[model samples]
Target: MKTIFTAIFIILLLSACTKTLDIKLRSTEPKIVIQGNVTNSGGPYYIRINKTVDFDANNEYPPVVNATVSVLDSNTRRVDYYKYTGVNGYYISNNLFGQVGHTYKLTVTVDGETYTASSTMPNFVGINQLDFVQTKILNKTRILPQVTFTDPAYEKNYYVFSLAVNNVTYKAFYAVDDRLTDGNEMVQQLYMDSSYIQKRDFVTVILSSVDKNVYNYFNVLQANSGASPTTPSNPPSNISNGAYGYFGAEAVSMVSQSF
Candidate 1:
């Protein structure tokens, strides 16, 4: 999925060189944004709880403290809990799980209401190679990262790849599913603004194998935030109790490239 900022940049730059947009965001009642994830890479994984801010307000997310959170392993029937770091709405898990085919359930109780989500860790898929290839976007030549991986056959698979430059992760995530090209040697190109890519910059690409629910959440989010995004609508959340954000369990493969 292209990031909102980078996608907007491509849309404007490729279309008319420059354009103006006037978006008026309406104020809505504050809702909590609870996001958490578990990876096969291991833990103490993180969970963040925050409330959405007003449109006219400063760009700040108010943290939701005093919430009780837990991650339970369905396979082992053991429970792993979390502790708030006392800032930034961050909660770190203890005794995390990394086993495949295990379902994990996350429970967060806030203000006497409980919100929950569950995810199962899929089988692992590793990146074969990483390459920086030149491509054209709307007649503009741009160098983008290409990842090579062998897609597994027979099962439905979904993926999300995220990029980080010099240890700073970009907010834009790329999500794709094995629809027509299942069981093929796939070369997926990551499209983003690469103007700041300098010589010898460390680049990291993480490919996540996610469940269908988690995939849908990010797929709709990616769609709504694409170039020439349509009327804004909320992305589907897997969390119960009407919360915003997602709780995901992913089996990930990571590859890094320099220069």
Candidate 2:
């Protein structure tokens, strides 16, 4: 009986000595995030500028309004101004369209600080054909869409692909470089996690020719997408002046099919 009481008292003393650990996480200063893209497909390109928030805060990123945004064509020396649309953080271009082989520069000024990035529009490549096939992924049969295209010989090329199902766009980090398959006819399969595509669904695929910096940005972004937010590192950004995100000028092509 004395040994049992001693054991119980020792257990109670250990429990009383245990204290909860309250880890205080320090929040970093907010930085601007800019996501902008210009493609050969059409005009009215948009640039979104927002400020990063604390890790514990909501996902809403406050927009940075009243900023001066412009796009400059290096070859033609023409500057296109963007106007804030009061919708989200979007700024739309008035009369600028991306052209292949021309370099474009993005400039944004907010709170007396300026951020800049440059990207050249790459040449367009066509998708030869697209088809759907049944394949087993993760022990489940799925109808996957595949695309076939011929990479140009003796040239370095990078591509970004996006899919739309039934008019709803699904953006994935499906970026590829033709380093291994250079000058070869390649058939690439497209995949997504949700498996929402079905038979007779309207599908649209967009293929964009991107520059090296943009390709690297997407490569890191895809790699880090699955990681925990507590990780210290961040994805590479092309925008300078302590900003996050990327600015890309791409030559784009699209094809649609009813699966």
Candidate 3:
């Protein structure tokens, strides 16, 4: 009798698993996507503009062309104009260069719609040294780059790191806040998804001092890097007027090593 009851329960469970439900998804209107940055490294900064596409359409984002772009130095009240480069909605500024401790405001007008955003360049911080150490993960040995720096005292700070291997930029995002390590020496380990880096591969690491907003943007982006499109939400943007993506003014320092 007990065996018969067990068989009956199994059959009921199998029947429940065979049911399927169709889910209908609704489509929404597209919005603008803006990605712009100004670094303390140099001039000739570019901003890319595009419109978001439908959910089921190809991943091609239509470039927004003929848009007027300009940057303003908030302290000096000087505006520098940008010309559309006629390629992929990129706008280039010829005269404006990012300066540390200066605030920059970006203005964009497209098809009678306007968007604005602002970012302040943080103070420059240089990396003290860089080294590589070997470690075992998932039963495999991998060499990872490590960076050391002294965090400034009595101030809140945020940072972003990028790695380039063999002169090709890796898309991995690394961001950190000095909340815990403030006023102390910090040693950070940098990683990549692949473990195929050899001793002959050339590597470059960039350390950028960023504002709190940019730090939060990169934090959310890194958290949702490998998530499904339907499962994860978009990263928060600094751009106003219902736009997506971030505008950053950052102080950058870099170091390179062959490993």
In model 1, what are the clashing residue pairs, if there are any?
Answer: 1-174, 1-175
Instruction: Tell me which of candidates 1 and 2 scores higher on lDDT.
Output: 2
Q: After superposition, how far is residue 49 of candidate 2 from its true place, in Å?
A: 0.7
- Give the C-alpha miss distance for residue 36 in model 1, angstroms: 0.9
Clash pairs for candidate 2: 200-259
Using lDDT as the measure, what is the rank order of every candidate, best first?
Answer: 2, 3, 1
For every candidate in turn, the CA RMSD to the true structure comes to: 8.5, 17.1, 16.5
Worst 10 residues of 3 by lDDT: 15-24
Q: After superposition, which runs of candidate 1 have C-alpha atoms over 4 Å from their true positions?
A: 1-27, 138-140, 194-196, 227-230
> What's each prediction's TM-score?
0.85, 0.86, 0.86
Positional deviation of residue 140's Cα in model 1 after best superposition, in angstroms: 4.2
Estimate, for each residue in 8-50, the C-alpha lDDT of model 3 and write its tens digit: 3332122111001111112256788777778877766777788
Whole-model lDDT, candidate 3? Answer: 0.75
